[model samples]
Target: MTTAERSGAVQDPDARRLADLGYTSEFHRDMSLWANFSLGFTYLSPVVGVYTLFAVSLALAGPPMIWSLVIVGVGQLLVALVFGEIVSQYPIAGGLYPWARRLWGRRWAWLTGWVYAIALLVTIASVVYGAGPYVSSLLGLTVSTNTTIVCALVLIVLVTVINLGGTRVLAIAALIGFGTEILGALVVGGWLLLAEREHDLGVLFDSFGAAREGSYFAAFLAAGLIGIFQYYGFEACGDVAEEVPDASRRIPKAMRMTIYVGGAAATFVCLALVLAVPDFGAVISGENADPVGGVLSTAFGDTGAKIVLAVVLVSFLSCALSLQAAASRLMYSYARDRMLPGSGLLARFSRSRGVPPYTLLVAAVVPAVVVGVSRFSEDAIVKIVSFAVLGIYLAFQLVVLAALRARVKGWRPAGPFTLGRWGFAVNVAALVYGVAAIVNMVWPRTPDAPWYDDYLVLLSGVVVVGVGVVLMAVTRPYRHSDAAADDAVRSTAAPER
Candidate 1:
C-alpha cells in the first residue's frame, strides 16, 4: 500500500479521482464550491444574454416572447440534470469530450470535443461583438464596422490576459462578475418595475402583430430562439472540473445552480425591460427599437443609463473571459490526452501558472480572427453567432444521445450524483428538447434571401463539423498516446486498490 493511502491521508483525492478516469491533475485544484459555481454562473451570464437579445425578442414576438424563458428554462434544466450526472462520474477538465469518450469511444468523443471547442471559440467572438454596441453607446461613439471590430478585439485581448494569470485569477474574476450581474439584475429590474412600468401585466400575453403570416405559433417559436441561446454555458463548470477539489460531487451541484440562478436572473431582467418600455410599439417596430437602452434611459436619464450599461459591459467582459477559459481548458484536456494535432505543444502546462499557455493563445487568437469577419459584413457576424448556437446545441444533444445509449446498455452512474430511476425519462426528455431546439434554431426564417444566405446557420454548422470530421479521418489521433495514457493511469491506480 502507498504511504499516503495506508496512513488514510489520501494526499490528493482530486488527483486520485482523475487517475481513475485516465487523466493527470496538472491543473491547480484550488477552486472552492462557490468558485466553481461562479465560473458556470458567469459563463451563463444573464446580464449579457438578456441585454444582448432583449430587443430581438421583443421585435420578434412582443411581450409574449418572455414565455420562451420558462419553456427553455425547463428544457435546459433537464439538460443540466443529465450533464450533472455525467460530470459527477467523469469530472475531467474537458467536459463533454472526456465524458463522451468514456461513455462512447474515441472517434465520437473527438467529434464532440471538436464541435464543442469550435462553438466555444465562435461564442467568444459573438459575445465580444455583441458587447460592441453597448460599449459604443456607453462611450457616446458611433458604432461603425471598424469601431466594432476594434472593440471586440480589445475585449478578447483583455480576457486572454486575465486567463493567462491562472485559475485563481479566473475564480476571482468570475466571482466579481457574478456579484455585479446579480446585483445589476435585481437592482435594475426592481427599479424598472417600481419607477418605469408603462404597461400592465397583461402585456406579456400580447403578440404585437408579429405573426404577420397569421400564425402566432410561428412567431412564438422564433422568439423562443432567444431563450434557447441564453440557457447554455452552465457546462463551463464541467469543463474545468479537474481544477476543482472534490469536483465529482461539487460540479454537479454547481451546474444545476448555474441554470437555476442564471435562468431566474435572465427571466427577471427580460420581464423588467419588457414592462418598462415606454412605447412598446415604437420600441418594437418604429424608430426606437432598442428597448433595453430606451427603458434604462427612460427610468434614469442618459447618464444613469450609461452607468448601468458600463456595468453590463463589465459583465460582457467577464462572460468572454469565462468562455475563453473554458475553451482553452477543453483544448488542453484534449491535447493532454493526445487527442489533437500538436498535442505535445498544446498540452504543455506552465509549471508555475498551471495553465496551457499555447492553448490560451490559440483560444484568444481564433476569436480575434473570427471577429475580423465583422469587418466584411455585419450580417456575416450574425450568421457566425447563429452557427455558434447551433454547434453548441448539436454537441450537447450528441452527449445526451450517448448517455441514453449508455443507459440502454446498462451503464450505471459511478459517482455520488445520479437521477436514480428517473434517469431514463430525464435523459429522453432532454434529448427530445435538445433536438427540437436545434431544429427551431436552424430553420431558415428568411425565404426571400438568396439560398446560401437563407441557410447560413445550417451551412456554417455543417462546414465546421465537416472540417472536424475530415481532420479526424486524416489524422486519426488518439491511436497511441491516449491508449498509453490510459494504460499508465490504470497501472498507477492499480496499487492504490
Candidate 2:
C-alpha cells in the first residue's frame, strides 16, 4: 500500500480538534519544548545517565566513557532526525502510532504503539527502582529490599497523583526538576574533578585494559545499547503533540533539538566523571552492590553527599512523574483508538482535572507489579529492566525504519523542521545502529543471563502492539474521524524531547 493509504488521517481536521480530544491547546510551544527536555534530561542529567556512564566507563571504556556516549548520541541523532521529519509532517499526539500507521499500515502501527506504551511502563518501573536507593540514602537509613519495594510504591503513587492532575502541572514540575538535575550533575561532577585535581588523568583515560581481556568491543557494544536508554523519552513530546499550539512544526523541531542538547550534556557529564572520579574499581563494585546510592556516596562526602542524594531522589521522582504523564496519555490514546481491553475505562478523562485519571491508574499498575517483583531479587530487577529497554529500542527502530521507507517511496509532506536532503543518510545510520544493538542485546555475555527473559519482554511488548492490531482487525469499520480516532491517540505517542 502507499504510505498515505497505510497511515490513518489525522483526527480533528477542524479547529475544534482540541475540545473534541478532551484537552485544550492551552500549552505554548515553548512550554511543550521545555516539558519534553525536562522529562528527557531529568532522568539522565546527574542521575541515571551518571550511574550508567560511571559503570561502563570504569568497567568497559575507562575514561573513554565519552566514546560510548558519543556513539550512542550519534545513533540516537539519526533516529531523532527521522522523528524530526515525521513529527513535522504529522504533528499530532499519538506521534509514533499515527506515524507508524501512516508508513507501515494499521496493523503494524497498532503493534508499534503498544510496544512503545509498555516499554515506558517498564521504564517507569525500573527508574522507580533507581530512585529507591537515593531515598534511603537521603534519609540516612540502610534499606532492606523490602523497604526498597515500599519506597518504590510510594514514589509510583506520588507520580500518579501529579500526572492525574494534568499536563500543565506535570510540565511545571518537569521544568523545576530539570533545573535541579542539571545543577546537581554540575555540582557533583565539578566538585569531584576539582576536588581531586592531583589524580592521574592518564590512568582514568586508559582503564579499559582492566576488563576481561579482549572484551572491550563487546563491552563497548553493550554499553552503547545501554546508553540508548539514557537519551530516550524524546518521543514523550509527541505524546502531547496535540496539546501544543502549532504542533505539526513545533513537535518535530522540539524533538530534534532535544536529542542534540541531551546528547551533548550527557557527553560532557561522562567526560567529567571519568576525569573527576577515577576510582572505577570502587564505583563499579559499589554499583554492583547498590547502583545509584553506591556511586553517590563515593562521589561526595557523608555530610555534603546527603544533600546531593536528595537532589538525586528528586530527580528520580521527576522521572517517575514524567513517565506516568507520558504513559497515561498513551493509555488514553490507545483507548480512544479502541485498541486496549479496557477502552471504556481508559477513555474516561475527568472534566474537572482535564486529565485521564483511569489511564494514569492503569499505567501505575504495571510499574507496581514490576517493583513488587523487584523486591524478591536485585538480579531479576536488572534483567527485567535491561530486557525492557531492549524491547523499547526495538519498537522505536522498527517504526523509524518504516518511516524512512515511506520517505524513500516519495511520501513527503511539507514540514518547517525538515532535515533537508540529508534525512535519508541519517535514517540509514539509525537503522544500522538499531539492528546492531538488537543483535548484541540477545547475545549473552554472562551465562546466567537468560535470553528468554529478553524474549519475554519482547513478547509482552509484541502482545501490547497486537492488541491495537486486533482492535482494527475485529471491530466494524468506523469512518476515520480526524476528530475522534488517531488524533485522540496523542497522549501516548510522544518523542523523548
Candidate 3:
C-alpha cells in the first residue's frame, strides 16, 4: 500500500494526472511543448508528403490540385479542433485508441485502434518504401524492386535504433528533421517561387484539361490524397501524451500548432513545385514521370539537387521515426488494457529508458514485412499504400463520430480546454468534413483500369475493417480490461492537481 498510497504531491504532476485517469507514467515526461509539436511536425513531414504525392496529384488534377491543400487544411483543422478537445480531456497514451475508449466504450476503441493501428503500420511502410528510390539514387545504386526493399529495411533498422535511444533522442531527431525540412522547403520553395517560376499564379487555376468522367470535381477529389496524407502526422503528438507534462493543455495546442505550421509548409512546397514545373503538359500527359526529380535537377543542378535530396532523406527518416513511435504507443495502450493478444509482451515497458521496447519492435517489423511485399510487384505497394490515407481518414472519422456521440449524450468536454458552446457545432462540422473526405477518397474513378485497381482504396478499407470485426467477434479482446472506464466517465472535470 505504500507505493499505492503515496500522495499526489509525492509524484510528478504528470504521473499523478495519469493515475487520476488510471494510468502510470510509463514514458519519460521530459518533452517540452516544442518537442511535442516537433513530433507531430516531423511526422507530418511537409517535404516528404508533398514531394511524394506532388507528381501524382499534379498529373491527376493539374496545377489546380494545389487547392486540395487549402481545402483539406481547413477540413482537417476542424477535425484537429475536435481532436484537440478530446485529447485535452483525456491526454492518454495511444491518442485515438484511448480517446475512443473513454468517449464511447471498449469495443468502439478496439475498432478504432485496429483501424488506426493498421493504417499507421501501412503508412510507415509506404513512407520508407517510397524513400527507397531516393536512397538508391543518393547512393549511386541502380534502383530496382529488390534494391528498394533493401534500402527500406535499412531505413527501418536505423530509425528503430534511434527510437530505442529513448524519448529525448526521439525529440532531438524530430526537431532536427523539422528544422531541416522547413528550412529546405523555404529555400527550395522560395527559390522556385522567386527564380524558377515557369508558370504564373494564373496556372494554379488552370486544370490543364484534367477531368475524370468529365468532372474536374471528381478528379480533384481523387487528387485530395495529397492533403489528406500531409495532415495526419499531427496526431502523433497526442500518441505520446504521457510523455509530456501538462499534457491536457499542451497537447491540444501542440496539435493545432502542427496543423497550422505543417499546412503552411506543405502548401508552400506544393505551390513552389506547381509554379516551377517547366513543362506542365508533359507532366500531366505522363511524358514526364519524374517531374519532381526533373524540377530539382533543373532548378539546382546535379550537386545542389543531391543536397536537397539529402534533406528529403532526413525528412523521411524523421517521419518514419515518428510514425513508428506513435504506432508503438498504440500497441502498448492496447496491451496495457489486455485489449489485444500478447498484451503482456507488448506492454513491457523500459523503466530506465521510458519506452515500450517490444511494441517498438512490432511497429518496425510489421512495416518491414509490408515493404518486402514490393518484391512481388511494385504496383502492389502503390495499391496497398493508397489505403493508408483513406484508412487513416476512416479511423479519424470514427473518432470524430465517437466524440459527437458522446457529446450528443451530454458528455460536455471538461478539461483545461473546451470548445464551450461551440463544441457541438464544431464536432458536427468535423464529422461532416470527415465523412465527405471519406466518400471522396473511396469513390472509384478509374474505369479503364482493372476493377481491383480502381476500387483498391475502398477494397483495402473494407478488408481492414472486415478483418477487425472478425477478430473482435472471435477473440472478444475488449472483454478483459482495466481501462478505468468508470473513472473515465466520472473524472471528466479537470483532473486532480
Best by lDDT: 3
* Top TM-score prediction, candidate number: 3
Summarize candidate 3's per-residue lDDT along 1-497 as a digit string, tens digits: 25554664356677666777887666788788999999999998898789888888898899999988899999999989999988887889999999989988888899999999999999999999889989988888898888889999999999999999899999898888889989999999999988988988999999887764378887887788888778888788999998888999999999999999999999999999999898888888889988999989999998999899999999999999999999999999999999989888888999888899999999999999988876876475456557888888988998998888877665778878888878888899989998998888888887898898788889989999999999999999988996765234455544222
Output the lDDT of residue 263, model 2. 73
lDDT (Cα atoms) of all candidates against the true structure: 0.84, 0.66, 0.87
TM-score of every prediction relative to native: 0.94, 0.84, 0.96
Per-residue C-alpha lDDT of model 1 across residues 1-497, encoded as one tens digit per residue:
46765344245777777666655576788788898998888888998888877777777788899999899999999999999988987888889888888777788889999999999999999899989888888888897777778889989999999999999999999999999989988999999988888888999988767766657787788778679778998999999997888998999999999999999999999888888887767755756767777678878898898989888999999999999999999998888888888899998989689789999999999999989966777465556667888999989998999888877766766577888878889999999999999889888888899888888888888898899989988888857454422121122211100
Task: Flag regions of model 1 displaced more than 4 Å.
Answer: 1-10, 484-497
User: Rank by lDDT, descending?
Assistant: 3, 1, 2
User: Which structure is stronger by lDDT: 2 or 3?
Assistant: 3
Q: Tell me the tens digit of each residue's lDDT in model 2 across 171-288.
A: 7888888888778777776776666432555654564354556576666665554466677777777777766666666667666666776676666566555565535555544445
Stretches of candidate 2 off by over 4 Å are 1-32, 43-46, 197-205, 281-299, 448-497
Better of 1 and 2 by lDDT: 1
Q: Model 2: what TM-score?
A: 0.84
The clash numbers for all candidates, in the given order, read: 0, 25, 0
* Cα error, candidate 3, residue 193 (Å): 1.5
